[model samples]
Structure formats: structure tokens, C-alpha cells
Target: MTTEKCDITPNTIVGDLLRDYPELEDKLIEIAPVFNKLKNPVLRKTVAKVATLKQAAQIAGMPVAVLINKLREAVNMEQIQIEQDSEGKTIKPGWVDKGKIVIEYDASLDIENGLHPAAKVTKEITNLKEGEIYLLITPFLPAPLIKIVEEKGYKTYSEKLNENTWNTYIGKQ
Candidate 1:
């Protein structure tokens, strides 16, 4: 018999939710197809460790309240409605200029080779000059990295270039 109940909240860590309620993986993917990457053993072990539900929502391009309510709804929890704009951050980065200085790092190869691009990207983002842009190309959305750099004042725009390619633009507004 199943013992764990889905206890997802705004602050829930993505990996913890998956580990505690493994069945919820399907539920999450159903809500956002981009979550399909969570199936990969490597990414699930690495990325999810640092990603919170809030960051996951940002990566999915959904408001935090919306994502939390959807997740809670999926598992029969009561929805807690909050004002829409309370947790807004990256609705759209008006700073992106579509210019050059793109630092393309395809993290899939690094992960497969046992190297993590988070550290490297962190160092690169620290060195970014105003108006400079870094385009992180990865197999999945770099949610944790976005959170870290965004806290340091970088704005971003994320888009899927293809099924296997997600490009996130990180720059200052």
C-alpha cells in the first residue's frame, strides 16, 4: 500500500517531492511537458537536488501560485489562492537585446561526461559586464542556475529551440 501523500507547497524542493511521492512525476510532467527531463537519472540526481517548486515554476513559465495550486490540485490538496503578482520576477526580461556575447554551454555533454556546468556558468555570470549576454544552451531548463544568477541581478529569457535544446538568455536589464 502507498504510504506517502503528496505534500507539495511553494517551498517544496523538486527532488524531495519526487523522492517522497515518486508517482507525482507523471503528474508533474502532465502539467508541464518540459518536466519530462526529470526522468533522466543524471538530471534527476543533479538538477532536482537544488531546484525548488518556485524555481521549477519559473522554469515552466508559470506563476508560482499557479504552479503550486496545480500541483496541489493534482494530488487532491486544497488550492490556496494568492494574489497573482506577489511572487512575480521573470515574467519577461525587457533587457534582452538579441545581441551577441552569447556564451553557449550545452550541459548535457558535460553531465554525461561527469562535469557540471553550474559552477562554470556561475563563474561566467559573475564576470558578465552590463549589457553583456550569456546564452546557456542545455538539454533541460537550468532552473537552479537561473535562480542563483537572478538573485545576483541578472534578468533572463528562456525558450525551447527544439525538443533537446533550451536556450536561456542571462543579462542585466
Candidate 2:
């Protein structure tokens, strides 16, 4: 079956896209396997309804334009141009030094063991020295924590490693 070209803007909701272009799901997962989260019913009921292509790109640690273009290609649409949003810190945090403190909290493991690591992570970030950074390793984007920490005045740069892993660099500026 020919999948007709569809307009997939950065603001397009994931659920809407999936309903209109089902095949694009596979292409999206191909772009970033973490998109497999779309299969989870809990997230589908919540995240998919509001998760935009731009947010998905942030979660996948890819450029918004790159992700959008990939989906556009999969749907046979002409590529569209997108300028980077200045709202986020550098996506690639090259400033992360090996000397910096790392709080490797696998939230997925915590969920399995019925524990919460957010408090512990918050403590570590609070204890950081002026020049120190906090490298938080997690199973997912840790969106809530990101917002909370940022609201507390820390700068962050998040990177997605694969389907089940992410690293968020938090600098207490």
C-alpha cells in the first residue's frame, strides 16, 4: 500500500500521526528505537496524545528537523526546514568532565524494586560544588525531574544513548 505524503510538523501529536499514517510508526521506531514506548498502553493513553515531534526529538536526543525530515521521507512528503529552538541548552554536553560527579540512577530498576531515586538524585545535585556537574543516567528522559531541576535554576543537556538509556547533564550555574 502506498503511504501518501502527510504534513508532519514538529508540533504534530504522535497519536494523530500514528492514526493517520500507521506505517510511520515503524519508521519512527527505526529513527529512534526508544519510540517503542509507543507500544505501552499507559503511555499511549497519556503521552502519545500530547507528545509532539519536537518533544520526541528531545527525548531521542536528535535534532527536531532531522526527526521531522525522517518521518516526512517515510510518508513521501517533501522535506521541510526547521530552525533550532533556543529554549534548550546544548543537546551535546561536551562540557561534561570525567572529574564531575555522576548520579547513575536507573529509574527503571527503581520501579522494578519499588524504590524512588528522584530524592537521592536531587540531593546529589544540591550538593554539587560550584564547578561540578551532575551526570544523571536514567532509563528514560526523566522529564519531570528535568523540569523540577531546571525550575530550581540548573541548566541541563540531555542525550539519549539507545532504546532504554539516557544521560542528562545538570550544571548548577
Candidate 3:
């Protein structure tokens, strides 16, 4: 067994983790069947590189800490414990009224084309007027994208519409 060279944390990128420990692939899929998509070499290279364990956990509908600890254990690393935040209420916030949605971008097509939607989403987000909302429709919970826009001072709310559709509302604060 290889000595622990990398700390398996929520911020760890899936691709980087796999590169260091290819054996974790089955463990990831075991944690969530959704990870089976990683078997696709194209997605493995594209999405995995950009996706963090936190985002992967969100996509798997599991707690990020749980996912990280599981991966760590598989590699004989120390497990960590942290208070997991609630997934939040399903009730939409008052600022997220559908009528207030000024723009709607479905990023599933871009993802299918192996393109990241950050640039387009950021550009569209900048176009939002005060109190206006931009709706981003993606195939899964875009945790990293939400983090990016939120860091830029946008308020975001994500809701899973179905197994394959996630709606993320971005509002200018």
C-alpha cells in the first residue's frame, strides 16, 4: 500500500484522488451508484478534474464529510468528523419567485459537449439587475458553480427537480 501522500478532504478533486489512488474508483461508486458515470473515460477526464469531493457528495445526495471519511478510510488515512449542514428547506425563498427570473440557461447541453458552464453562467449572472434572478438548469447539483457565484456575492438556491434535473437560482444580492 502506498503511504498517505494526499489528504482526502471534501475539497479534493476526484481526478486528483483517482490519479493518486485508482483503487478508490470502486469505493466511490460503492458510496453512490451515480459515480458509475466515472467509468466513462471522457467524463472521468473532464468532469472529475473540475469536481471536488463536496460536489460529488452533493451529486450523490450524501453528506460531504461522509464521502470524505469513506475515501480516507479506504486509503488508511485518518478519518475526520465535522458537523454537516442541513440540506436546507425545500421551501423557496421569497427572492426566488419564478416571475422574477430574468434569465434561464440550460447548461446540460454544454456539459454534454464536455464544456464547463462557469464562464457563461458568470456572464449571465453579471447581467442580472438588482432583485432579478437567473435560473441555471443542470443535470445535477452544481455545487462548485454555486460556490463560485456565491463567492462573487450572488445569493444561490439549488433544488433538485428530478433524478436528472437540478434548478439553481442565482440572485444579485
Best by TM-score: 3
- Per-model TM-score versus the true fold: 0.56, 0.55, 0.67
* Candidate 2 lDDT, 1-73, residue by residue in tens: 9766336997787887888888888889999998998988988776777666776887877788889988888
Candidate 2, which ten residues in sequence have the lowest lDDT sum?
Answer: 85-94
After superposition on all CA atoms, how large is the RMSD of candidate 3? Answer: 4.8
Candidate 3 lDDT tens digits, 12-102: 8888899889999999999899999999998887788778786787678777788898899998888997555465223457798999998
Winning candidate number (lDDT): 3
Give the lowest summed-lDDT range of ten residues in model 1. 83-92
The number of residue pairs in model 2 that clash at the backbone is 0
Instruction: For residues 3-96, write the lDDT of model 1, one tens digit per residue.
Output: 7654787668899898886778998998888899999999898779878787687677777787788878876789985545555543444576
Clashing pairs in 1: none
**Candidate 1 displacement at residue 34 in angstroms:** 7.4
Worst 10 residues of 3 by lDDT: 82-91
RMSD (Cα, Å) of model 2: 7.1
* lDDT of model number 3: 0.85
TM-score of 2: 0.55
